[model samples]
Each structure stands twice: as structure tokens, then as C-alpha cells.
Target chain A: MSQHAQDYTPSEREEHQAMHLLPVRRADLPFLISLALIAAVYIVLIVGILAAKVFYVELPLIGEVFTNPGYRYAVMLSLISCSVTTILSLWIAVPAAYLMTRVRFPGKRLVDAILDIPIVLPPLVIGLGLLMLFQTPPGAWIQQYVRFTYAIPGLILAQFMVSCAFATRSMMASFAEINPRQEQVAVTLGCSRSQAFWMVVLPEARRGMIPAATIAWARAMGEFGPVLVFAGTTRMRTEVMPTTIFLELQVGNLGMATAVAVVMLITSLVILVLMRVAGRGMRMM
Target chain B: MIEFQDVSIQLGSFALEHVQLHIPTGTYAVLMGRTGCGKTTLLEAACGLRPLQAGRIALMGRDVTDLPPGQRGVGLVPQDGALFTTMTVADHLGFALRVRKRPRKEILARVEELADWLGIRYLLPRKPHGLSGGERQRVAIGRAMAGHPDVLCLDEPFSALDEETHADMIALLRRVQRDTSVTVLHITHNRNEAQALGDHVHVLKDGVLERQDPKLWKK
Candidate 1:
């Protein structure tokens, strides 16, 4: 400041700098204004909701809901059925994915198109179709061997039909990313077809498979329409978490419904985080 | 000895017809061809990777045309080095040995020996992605050699290497061939490589084998 004061007065120095350095033009003003507007809107919508204390609704007493033996049984049945659905979907989907990706057979494209039908069809329609099939004469004759209509088996079947397609689609993409030539090389080297697949292809595709499984599990856990129609939303029999939320909301128990929704949100968030981590590890591999 | 007697195949638009070739035991032969001339298909036919529509492939006087690649006793190093991405260099070299139920110690020793021979001993612990093109080719060759196959088919093994490295590789392969006495069918589009490495060169153009001029290729 002493050196500058000695050289020139503040006004003279400002004039000198202005003469050398050009002022910013107004050409970029529109872009900056648009960016600022977008940022403001985002902050008001996203940050405002997250920051608002009104959105934070507290849970009511759990004692009343837990005391009801029917709720407890419903929860237990949901956990068991969802777990079974996840396991069965994985077991069936893995092989289906592998075969669909690796093998060449007659009507391969037809089988692929058929597998896709479950994913695109409305779950309610799927449930209705299942209902008609299991209740009708030809389907009823088959049902004698295995109970399906309005039973636990029907719920599991509906869930499986809805979720297996999702699992297969994800796993198929994962399997496709892996080069089949790797498996061919392994087989030529000495491993049998199965051995080569298990050792070489599976390990490489494991990361993709994990997320597929997780997605399937998450979808199965949250499934409602099919389970309701196929298994019937019985109080202590086939009532899963979503069914519980629906039943509670119908009876005008807002607090309990919100609680179930919160639980579902937490579960979904945890699964999504796990999937992200798995996907990242897969990329590193 | 490996022999192809009037072998022919048609894959979509590409075709290889009436191809007859022979490789005497312990001699290194090169298949010289331009692109789209069905050189790779010939190799595939010889290795049992592709089915032959006509004619037969005989390995050590046994008809192996219908046999699978594993049962053909022929090792193939594909053009891209095709090393298993999930396995380490040592694991790849020892793959066939492990599949054949060889002892772990023996497999390790052979892998180390081949790795050292190829000047890639230090790279044994690394994965294929960590290797240079030359190093990958070395590992592919080592893996093929590890199987102790009757014949080795190298499909443009040095094509990906730089000129200097390619020269070095040619010398290395010659030494390896002299030592092992393993019959090799080296496929390449480069005329210099064919002349340098081949004891006999079969020139292929548009899937047809041209008459060879023995005097054109010198030692």
C-alpha cells in the first residue's frame, strides 16, 4: 500500500487498471442467470423438503401394533415368504441367465421374448391371470398336484413370476458383458463346460449377479398387487408389509401406515446403498 | 504330425474350400495370407474350433475332425492372446496342466521355466491386463507350451508388438522351437515374418493356396 501510494493515488491507479484490463461483457449474462435460476429452484424443492421439520413425522407407539398377534404372524409370514422367493429366484434365475447367454438352441429368441412378458405385464393383470388359471378346470386339474389359488403357494408363485424376470434380465446383462471366448478357452485348456463356467465365467460375472439378486429381493419384498390378488390379503396369513400399510390406511390408521412406509423406505435405501457398493467393486474388478 | 486333407468350410459369407496342408513333426510352418483369406478359419478347422463341412483333420495319424478342441491335442494361441482375464500369468500358463491333473509343483516349475524363457519371469504374479502386448503374447505362448501339445498353432502372435519387440519375439520363438522340437503352424499376414520364421510358407489368397516358390524364402 505504501509503494502504491508513493507511485499513484487510488483513483489514478483504478483508471490505469481499467485502461489495461477490459470489463466483462454482457454476452454471458443469460447463461449465468439461467444457471442461478435452476440452482434456486433445486434448493427450494430438494433442500427445502430435506430441511423441513414438518416432513419428519414421528412414529406412534409400537406396543399396540406389536401386541396384535395377527400383525406379528403377518410379519413372520412376509419374512419367510420373501426369503423363500429370493432364494428360489436366485437358484432358477442364475441357471436361466447362464443358459440364455451362453447356449444356442432352437427357439432361443422365442424363450427370451416370453421371459420378458412378466416384466412388462401389469402385476394386477398377472395376478388375475394366475387367479383364472388356478381356479379353472384345466389349471385346477394341475392344481390338485400343487395348491395355488388363494394360498401361500399362489403368493410365492406370483412373486416368483414377477421377480424372476427381473433377476434374469439383470443377470443376463451381466453374463453378456463377460466374453464367452473366455469360457471357450478354459474348456479347450482342460476344464469341462460346467467347470469352466463355474471357475472362470461366474467369478468374473459375480459383481453383476449380486446386484441382480439384491434387486430381485427388493422387488419381492415390496410387491403388493400380485400378492394381494393371488394370495388374498388375509389378516394373519398372507399380509406382507405393503399389505399391512394398505390395510392400515383403509382402516384410517395414518400413523401406522406411515410407520410401515418409513420401514420400507429404510429397507430400500439400505439395499440401494449395498447395490452401489457392489457395482463399484464390480467396476474395479 | 498334423495334417489337413482337402478341408473346406463355409461360414456365412466367408469360405475355405479344398485346403490341403501338412506339418511334419518338429517343423515350424507358417500360413501366409491376406486379410479375409480364411487363415483363421483354417486354424480353427485344424484345432477343431470350427466344424469342417468336407475333408478330415488328422493329428498324429488319428482323425480328429469330429473331436473337440480339448481332445485334439493341439494348443492354440489366438490372435488377441485370449488369456483368461481373471487369472494371473502363472495361473494361465498352468491352466492345461491343472486341468490334466498334473502335480502343482511340476506345473509351477514348468510355468516358471517358460516364463523365464520368454523373459517374463517377473510378470508371473501379474494379471493379463497389467502386461504389455509383447508380454501378453509371451504368456500366451507359454500357456500353449505348458500343455505339452503335439502341435501349437500361433495366430499372428507378434502382430500386436512394435517392430523392435516383434524382431525380438521372432528370435525367441525360433530358439523355443529349436529347444522343444514342437511342431508349430504360425499364421501371419507379414511376408517378412513368414520368411524369417517359417521353414515352409503356404501363401493363401481368397481362401486358395498359391504355389510356393522355395527360392524366394531364404534361411
Candidate 2:
């Protein structure tokens, strides 16, 4: 019955205050904590580099780096190697992931456990392992036929071994998210297994491909330790964008080193944005 | 026609033990059971979606126990319709014909005919996410029939619809039977649905099937 602005019914005032308190009360603490932890990781690894770039990066030096023959060769190798690595990784991962998700086999759990090795192992250890493999008798036979160590091919191979795991993991997640019932229905409606796969299952898994390929490409772009050990940091030979930074830092040109680093950061961001956009477009279609 | 004799299959904790079933041609049969009673398992075994552990399956008088599902000439409309979310309704209807590599003109014409018959021509371009429960089921039925399969197996197809929609779908099935002679094995838990739609009804309990309501649906 009170008409004063502050004199309100309990129900009406509570409803008004509830709007303000609801978010604070119902906030998903665990999810926010999980997201914040992941965000903290990105901020530390990525933002630290960007912050370093703010002091060391001079816009005019970009042209100097671009014009240098060594830098140009590094950039070209990075582009070419990452592209090949991404393609090879996807080619290997797609079918492997399909099997991992759809098939039931005796050693499947072991095989799945093995896939995480490259992902979890230290980068230098992978390079060292590749080096040891090349030194073995069977590896020697292949080396005679196709020399990889200390060569451009070695650079690609090292990147491939490391980045392929990321590709496979993402693709496995993609394939796992899809329900097998759709393909089963397709089969009963007269589609052979392969037909069902290519028509129904593959199309459904297309969204997964974007993330798989993007993450692999970014990983390949930043690969340093494996390339340094297995491929060697030879100028105009196995040099890539990451090696360019190492070479610059060797001479104490920290500004020039961070400039190359800044370029990689920009490249990685652009790549992720493109993949997300492509994924959204495919979903809409 | 579909037949399963001495069929034994297991999936996780569920099993179909020595199950025997027969659906004669041109009949709309309902297989009724409580939820998780393995009714869908039996249906899937006949369709070759699940391998039978120890028995024979025959489809349209052919011994297809060891054959692949596509080779068995079965058209399945699974629970929730299972329509490909990415495809249009027209794509769903034309899927079988496309898989068989029918000529484009023939496939399009057949799709149009089915779309008209199922009253989903206007919804053909829409994706599954936009359709109502009844609309999705209609598209699914059309899709299943597109292959001209000898047997059409629907697993709880109408269980998701409202009462009005359920009745409408039942009437649609009757019309579909008038138009085509496909043998249908529909799985459901509802006694009322069995009474309304079945020409021959079978009750499944503990992985065993028994013919029910002899006086009501003698055929």
C-alpha cells in the first residue's frame, strides 16, 4: 500500500535484488577456474612474448628482416615446411582417427596410449630419438636411399613427427563427437561402408579437420628444438622462422630476434582466426 | 520379409539369446517391450547392424546372415530419426537412391514424389535442426522407403511425438502401406501404439518374443 520509492513490498524488492545477485550466486566457479587456468597459460607463454616484442620490436626493422636473404630463406622454409607437415599430418591422422574412434580391437588401448608419446615427450628428446633412428642399420638403408638428417627434408620430418600427434589428437576428438548411428542408418539405406564414410561420416567430421590442421600448422611453424638437433640450424638450408630468432639472439640482436618472434605470433593468431571462421562457415552450411 | 532364427547377439551388458522372429511381406508388425528389453537389439541383429553370435538371418528369402547391412536390403529409421544434421530434408529422402548411383533425374523425381507423398515437400530444403518431431519422422520414413527395401525397420519412431502428432504419423503409415508393399517391423513400448498400428504384434520379454492378441490381429 506504501507509495514511497524506498517503501516496496518484499516480493517486488527481492525480485529486483535477485536480478543483481543471481549471477554472483549461480556463477560456475569450477568452469571459470578451469578456463582461467588455461587463459593464464596462454597469457604467460604468448603474452610474455608480445610484451617482450613491445620493447624490442621496431616497425622499421620488419623491412630489414624481410629483405635479408637469410631471413627470407627462413620465412620461406617455415611456410613450405609447415604446409607440407600439415598435409601429411592430416593424411596420416584422418583414417587413423576414424579407426581409433569406430573400431574395437585387442591392442587399441595400447595404440591409443602410444599416440600421446610425441605430444608428451620433450622436444629435444624427439629430435634425439629421430637422430638415433637414422643411425641404426634399417635407418641407414633408408638414409642411403633418401638422405634426411641435416637436410631440408629432415626439417620437415622432424616437424611432422611432433606436429602429427596434435593433429591426430584433435581429429580423434572430432571423430569421437560424431554419433555412429548416422552411418549405421546410411548403411541400411543402401550405402556401403566406404560410401557411408565418404558421404555421411566424412562430411560430419569436416569441422574437426579445421582445428586439426590449424593446430598442426601452428605447431610446425614454431618448432625449434627438433629442427636444431635433427635438421641442424644451417642457414639457407634447414633454417625456419624459429631458427631465425635463435640465430639473431646468438649475435645478441634481441630486437631483431623478437621481431621475428612477433611475426610468428601474428601468423599464429591469423591462422587460428581463419580456422575458426572456416569451421563456423561449414557449420552454417 | 525378414526372418531371424536362433540368433544370438551381445552388446555390452545386453544380449539377444536364441531369438526367433518372422515378419511376413506387406505387414506392419509391432515388437513391444519395456525400455532396455533388447527390442532394438533384435531389430538391429536382423538388419546386420549387430552381428548375430550363432544364428541365421534371411531377408526377402535370401540368406543374408553373413552379408553386410547394405547388401541385406534393409532400410532403417532409428530412434530420434537419426537424420544427418548437416544434410537437407531432400538429401535425406534421396540418400539411398544416390548411394545406389541412380541417374540424377530419376533420383530428383523420386525425391519429389516421396516429398509430396510424405507432405514434406515444403520442408525439403530445411535442415533437421529446424523440423518438428513429426516432420523429422516423416522425412525419416521417406528416407527409409527411398531404397525400396524389402524390410523397413523403425525403432521407436513415433515415441517422441505428441498425441495428435502420433495419430497423424500412424495415419501416414497406413497411407504409406497403401502406396508401397514394404514389410515394416516397428519397435515400441506403448501398448496403445501396438493396438492401433500393428497388423501382427509380438511382445518381447527378457530377449524372448511371443505373438500377442491373436484375436485382434490374426494376420
Candidate 3:
């Protein structure tokens, strides 16, 4: 049996890693079982769906959806909208997160609480709120110039509304990891307040920002509720991957819907790989 | 020159009330204190990095109680060097010059001059990740002095160095103080460090400054 795989002794690195972990015993079996069960629940939900799609659906149908012209446009639109939304979200989140971290004022805590409103609220409700805003007099007047409701801009707005909160939260966590003393030293070294922030704090926070942007992009890419409600599921105009799957399923096209789901799964995996690469690149820097 | 008159500030669980401290121009003053004493707090307040509730800070004989850190003309090297991990050693040295939009040639010359004086010319191109404690501290001191600051504040900058490196750093600091005549307010726990480098020594205990002659530092 190949020399019993060299006896499988733990390496020094493994022993060191185990040093940090709490001691395990027979009494911990129940806790370990519970942990395994919880992990299994999550794995089943994520992996099970992809497995089901491959097993129940025809391979040619999945391939056809992959190359479909309508599905292709949906993918392009989703990419464009999500990328734009991520950029806009970062533009707002970076400064907002920095302000939240550094500055204090009356109602600062309340402002923090308000930021969570978007995250806590249902995605569809956020979309409905955006739609309701355009129905208001000022929103309608502004709409004359900015085309927001049921338009491509509205689709981006919906994704941004849902994704920006996550972006801000992630960036805030990123900025928090940096010690405030770094900025103080930068200022003492003759950099102005803004200079210290831009040159020192921002560059140092890049690692955190990468995850923030990636999470926002992924959230935008997969966003359905807000886009459906605010942007509308217009064919070829606003139909994204999630909406495409919905429309196909409405007509009892199981194979088509499964194919669209597979596309999303593949795209998500690709994004995850890209995120890992970016994280590694950031660490190298 | 640096002066803190009746300075009062509360930081976390520590509080300083009616603390008075003064350092004359060109004097190498060390504030020695036990761990958890408000030594770094005092240093920060004096440098305009921390706000004082009720008192004034004067640098170079002018009131700077309300000035921001950059405008107060004070340079600070915090404990652990706090070097920007993203920057090369040269960038750290030239950061102040670049901020002020100084000429490229001038910035280069000043950085080169400092690198030579600090004996860190070899480290200019390298980032801080591979630097030893002594090298990091040297870079930190160089960065602080790069601005040609009116007053230089150092918070235990040499504590991380080995005994030999520590002694070398003390000599280097004394040489820098003599060459530039910049006022210095350093805080440290090491009595030997205070004895070797301080022209005037002070002890901070129970949130107050008590002046002592440098001769008594070893005792």
C-alpha cells in the first residue's frame, strides 16, 4: 500500500497551527458534529444547486444558453452595470468610510445607523424606494435630465443602491485595520491632512479596498430584486442573467433556466478566482 | 523650542491634569517614565497630534496650541517607527518635499544628503518589509528630520534596537541634534538611554513632569 503513505505524521507547521487552536477532546464531539452539520448545510445549498443543474439538465442546452445572443447581451449589460456600479460605490464609499472612521460629530452614530438601513432593508424595498423617488416631483424633474426609472441608468441605480452599502461597510473595515498613528506621522513629516490621507492611509488600505470592490461587484452582478422592481425585466434592454433565468422558468423552460444558472455559477467562480489573484497581488505589494 | 503649559488631556483610561513641560532650543530632553505612564500621550499633545483640553503649546516661541500637526512645524517619530509599508526608504525620506511640491533636484539632493548622514543609502530603494528594527528606526528618524522641522519629537524610537545598535543610534541622534540644533523631546523607559543621549532629563510619573539633572539619570 505504498508504504502506508509515510505514516502521515503532522509537520512542524501543522503543529504550530494547532497551538493556536483550542484543545479537542472526546467531550467536544458534540460541538464538532454541530460545526460539521452547519458547514454541510452551507455547502449543500451552494454546491448542491450546481450539481443539480448538471445532472438534471442537458449539456447542449447549457452550451446553447452560454452562446445565446440574448443571453450574451444580458451578460454584457450585467458586466457593464455592475462594473459601473462598483466604481460609483467606491467613489462614495472610500470618502464616506474614511469620514466615518476618522471624524466625529453630533449624530455620528446615527449616521452610522443610517448607513445600515440599506443593508438591513430588503433588496426589493430598496428598488421600490428608488422607483418611488422618481415618482416624486423633484425626482421627476431631475429625471428629465438623468433618465433613471426603467432605463439602463435605473438598472445601475438599483444595483448601486443594493451594493454600495456592502462596499461602504467593507471599506470601513479596511480603513479601521490601519492604525491612526500612521496618518499622524505622515502629517508630522510635512504632509497636509489630505496629503497624509491620500499618500499614506489610502495606499495602506488597498488590501481592504480590493475585497470591498470585489464584494460590491459580485453583489451587483447577482442583484435581481432591485433590478427587477426598479429597472424592469425588459428583454434585451435590461434582462440580466438572474432575470433571464426567471423569464425562462416562467415559460417552463427548465433546461434553459438551468443553463442560465450554470452561467452565473461559472461567472461567480471566475470572479472568485480573480478576487483571489487580486488579494495575492495586494499581499505581494 | 517646545513648551507645554498646564496641559490637560484625557486619553482612554489615562488622564493628565495640569501637566507642565518645557524644552529649550537645541536641548536633547528625555522624558523617562514607567510603562503605562502618560509619556507618549504627553509627547503627542506637545506635537499637536493630540488635543489639549485646557492649555497652550508653544513651538519656537509662538503659540501653536490650535495648529494642526503639519502646520505646527513639529516632526514626530512614534514608537515602532510606524513606517508606511507601501513606501520605499527613499519615498519616506522625500515625502515631505514631494508634499510641498519642491523641485525634483532639490528633493533628490536633500534625500541623498540625509541617506548619507543616516548611513542608509543602501536602503533607499527597498521597502520596509525586509528591514530590521534598527534600519526601520533609522528610516523613521530620517523621515522626521527630512522636513527640516523646527522641533523633532521621538517616542521611544530606539527601544527596538540591540544594545550595540542602540548605542550607535544614541550617538547618531546626538550628532543630528548638534548638526541641526532642532529641539527634541524624547520619551523612553531606559535609564541608560536617557543617560547617554539626554542633555536635560525629566521624569513623568503620576501624570506630572519633574525635572532632573542628566547626571542623576543613571542613579
Candidate 4:
């Protein structure tokens, strides 16, 4: 036996055997390095962009984002809308995603593809579709009652239209990851379908809710084209962070635009971090 | 009593056609088959988890073909235990009682009784994530039997246990059936399991189920 082989303790020998079973060849080094280098390039670019925003932007302008009433209203609107949208998205997404994952109905494939339309379709098209929908007789009828065109409600509708799709996708993957047998066992234990969902499926899928909400909130915060087209960028009225950035840029206030973008980046990062921490906490339980 | 009258089920490329099975009241019946011979499919169909293409399922002499799983009065212990990850062992034991809206005192008494019967009184406070394979299966059995259904179905519950644990589980199940006198339909490919626990044995081969002597476990 080789010296290394002779030196290995029982645990070490087992690990060594495992390592040998899935041996990596030295010739694969260049291929592995190339794959890692490609990944690093994307990582570097993301960090580089974020760093540029933090470094190049003035602090006073960012301070104005909090102090200025127009920006303040926009920030408050963005926070409120994103929060509302996240809640609304989950309300729809959880049940819809669960159904999509569990049920097999006619036109299920078509329904699945249609559900993904907002995710795959350009944001502008979603806004345009909303825009065109409100012009139809049914849309006009609903508009007469609620008024969604170029209004605060329009902002939420546009965000929900797109954000709910993402939330649903996340939830669908979550439900799919859970074993159907759990729900079956619950049913056999005298739980009705809805009761099984509430008791067995929902609790297991709870950890997944954080990421779904995070994704929905992040997508809603970053939403630009849909909000712009569906809800006009009216300052202090229908303005949000994304629209604020657009309005600032249109007026050639580069500092203000960068500041708003930075604020958004920070908020999204905080949410992402909180979500990851909460997910970890749930798993620990 | 549990009966499958001319049951037919199709899942993707795999199918079980015109399958008939019956387990008499208070008897332990084990169904043996090859790995992909639709053992679980049959179990699921009996539990009303799967939609039957043809035939009726009766539990306690009631036709459960049109009934949903929850209304079928059946209890299931799946292969993996499929315990609720978020619930404690006490919660799992009390789950069916809670679902049926039984009195809280009654649930507590029953949960304690089941925990004691399964030799898992110490595990009642813990979750399934920290359990051993034998413990999880015991919890699954407790959860199923907690419901006090007309029939209980166990699908390969002992397939993942160590030898000692397997033997313990076999003895525990035998004792459980003896004590409760609940009708049971257990599925296993292991001939030893069938021989050990089966009061009646049925083998599924080439889409057909045929009764065999419980003592005869020939190929």
C-alpha cells in the first residue's frame, strides 16, 4: 500500500474511497477553470455596476431622495405598493400555484404556458396589454366603476399582473418539491382537500413563501416599462422609484436619478438578505 | 373490510388493468410484487389517492368509488412516512383527531395512548426531521392508526429500515393489528415481510392479482 493509503484512519479511508469513486481527471482542469472564469466575469460586472453607483453618486442628492417631498412621496408609494403587491401576489400565487402543481385538467399545458406569459413577455407588452384591455367594453365598464387607467390602482394592477406571475412560478416550484404523498396521507387522515392544503401542504411550503415574496417584491420594485405605460409618471401622484428615476433622467438630473437607483438597490439588497436569513431560520426549526 | 372490484388504473406508460383485491375484516393482507409492478399504484387506488379508470372500491362495505379520499374512511402509511415536516410527533399523532374536530381532551388522551403503544412516548415532542427510520415509520403508523379508520394501508413502510429496526417494526405491527383488530393492506416486495406478517398473501404479476397461501412464498 502507498504511504498515504497506510496513513488513513477508518473515517479518512472511507472519505478516500468516496473520492476515488468519483475521481476528477487532471485534464478537466482547463475546462473547469474556463467555466469558473465565465461565472466570475458576470459576478465582477454586477459588483462593478453596484460599486459605480455607490462611488459616483453624491451623498447630498441621495439625502434629497429622503428629504425632498416629491422623492419622499415616490419612496413611500413604492414601499406601500410593493408591500401591497407582495401580499396580493402571495394571496393569488399560493392557491393558484398549488392547483397548477397538483391538478391535472384539460388545457393544463396551455394554462401553464399562459400563466408564464407575463414572466416571458417583455414588461412593456404586459403594460400595453393592460392598456388595451381597459379600452375594451368590459375594461371600459370596469373602468367606469373603479378607474384603473393611468391611476394609483393602475400602478398596482400593472405590478400585480407581472409580479404575481413570478410569485406563482416560485410557489409552483416549491409545491412541486414537496411530496404529494404528504397531502395524500393527510387526506387519508380525514383532512379534506382544502384542509390538507392548510394543514399539511401549507406548513411544509411555508419556507418557500419568503423567496416567493422576495422575488415578487424585487420584481415589483424593478418594474419600469409596465408602470410607465400603464400608470403615467405623474410626480407625487402616480410616481414610484422606477418612474422617479425615469422622470429625473428625462429632466437631465443625473445625480438624482443615480441616487434613486442607489436607494432602490439598497432596499432590494436588505430584503434579499432578510429573506435569506428568514429562510435559514425556518429550516433550522 | 376492503375490496377492489375490477380496478383499472393508468399512470403514464405504466398500467394495472382489471385488478381485483380484497382484505377481510381484522386481517393483515400483504401484497407482493416486483419493483415496478404497480404495487404503490394499487395501494393509492385503494386509498382513493388515484382516480380509477374502472371499478369500485369499498371500505367497510361502503362503495367509496365516488368518494374523496378524506371521506373514504381509510388510513395510509406511505413508504417514506411522508410526515408533516412542520409538525411535532404529538401533532402528527393528533392530526386526524384535530381534523375531525374531536374534543381537545380526547385528542390528547389518544395521542398519548398511540405514543405509548408505538413505544415512541419520548419522541412525541420531537419532529420527524431528527428521527431515525424506525422512529419515523412508527410515527407514521401512529398517525395512521390515530384516525381509527375502517381500513389501514401500509406501502413499503419497512423497506428502508435496518435489520434490527425491521424486526422491531414487524413485531410492533403484529402487536398493533392484534390489539386493534383493524383491517390492513400492506404492500411489500420482500417475501420475508409477507411471510412474517401476512394473514393472507396476494401477488401481482403481469397486471393480475392472485391469492396465494400465506406460508407459500415461491417465485
lDDT of 3 at B210: 89
Best of the two (2, 4) by DockQ: 4
Residue range A1-285, candidate 2, lDDT tens digits: 111222222345577678777463446888878889998998898767678786678987777778989888888789899999999999999999999998898999999999999999999999999999999999899999898899988999999998999999999988887768888999887788888899998988887899899989999998988999999998999999899899999999988887788877877888889888887787778
* lDDT of candidates 1 onward, in order: 0.78, 0.86, 0.85, 0.89
**Model with the higher lDDT, candidate 3 or 4:** 4
Cand. 1 TM to true fold: 0.82
Q: In TM-score terms, which candidate is top?
A: 4
Candidate 1 CAPRI level: incorrect
Chain B TM-score, all predictions listed: 0.93, 0.95, 0.96, 0.96
Stretches > 4 Å off in candidate 4: A1-28, B217-219
lDDT of 4 at A273: 97
| The best candidate in terms of DockQ | 4
For residues A173-192, write the lDDT of model 1, one tens digit per residue: 87877766567667667677
Candidate 3 docking: what grade? acceptable
Order candidates by TM-score, high to low. Answer: 4, 3, 2, 1
User: For model 1, how does the per-residue alpha-carbon lDDT over B55-119 read when each residue is reduced to its tens digit?
Assistant: 99998788988887888787778777777766788898888888889998999898888888888
Choose the strongest candidate by lDDT: 4
Clashes per prediction? 0, 0, 0, 0
Model 3 quality (TM-score): 0.90
